[model samples]
Target: MPKVISNTSPILYLYRIGGIQWFSKLFDEVWVPEAVKNELRAGKIQGYDVPNPADYSWITIVNPKSMPSEWLALDLGIGEIAAMAGN
Candidate 1:
């Protein structure tokens, strides 16, 4: 089974465009880091129309055990960093 580790933007944009189900259709499992989940939750709290990862059965929330020190030097959002780290 193939899986993909996703960040926040793809999920957000896909959900907005009513294409979020493509994740389940394309991959056996959609893995999301905790940071991605948090970002979506924060967006929802801000009243934006964000889909909750928990709402999708195929979306699995994963917390990376440790992030690479090199990644901390890059200018990326926590969700992106976490997704890469998870990968």
Candidate 2:
């Protein structure tokens, strides 16, 4: 299925600011990666706040087919990679 491939920036930003519902309103489902999850945890451990959105259910994490490490490899980054793979 063609879905949004979300990342850490938008999730954390929205969460901390308590704007998660808006994310749900904008996309059918918001997705993240393990890398992004790890980053979130690291922020929490470092005493950096996280956006909880405890009641929000639209956000999720998915590991797609492997991708190259460097963003430069793909002009549009991994979201583009996953979108391409969907076809």
**lDDT of each structure?**
0.95, 0.61
lDDT of 1 by residue, 1-87 (tens): 689999999999999999999999999989999999999999999999999999998999999889989998999999999999884
For residue 25, give model 1's deviation from the true position in Å: 0.5
Kindly list the per-residue Cα lDDT of model 2 for residues 1-87, writing each as its tens digit. 345656667777777687767777777766666555666677788998875423357767666666645644766644445433422
- Per-prediction TM-score: 0.95, 0.66
Question: Candidate 1: lDDT over CA atoms?
Answer: 0.95
Q: Show model 1 residue runs off by greater than 4 Å.
A: none
Clashes of each: 0, 2
Residue 4 of model 1 has an lDDT of 97
- State the TM-score for model 1: 0.95
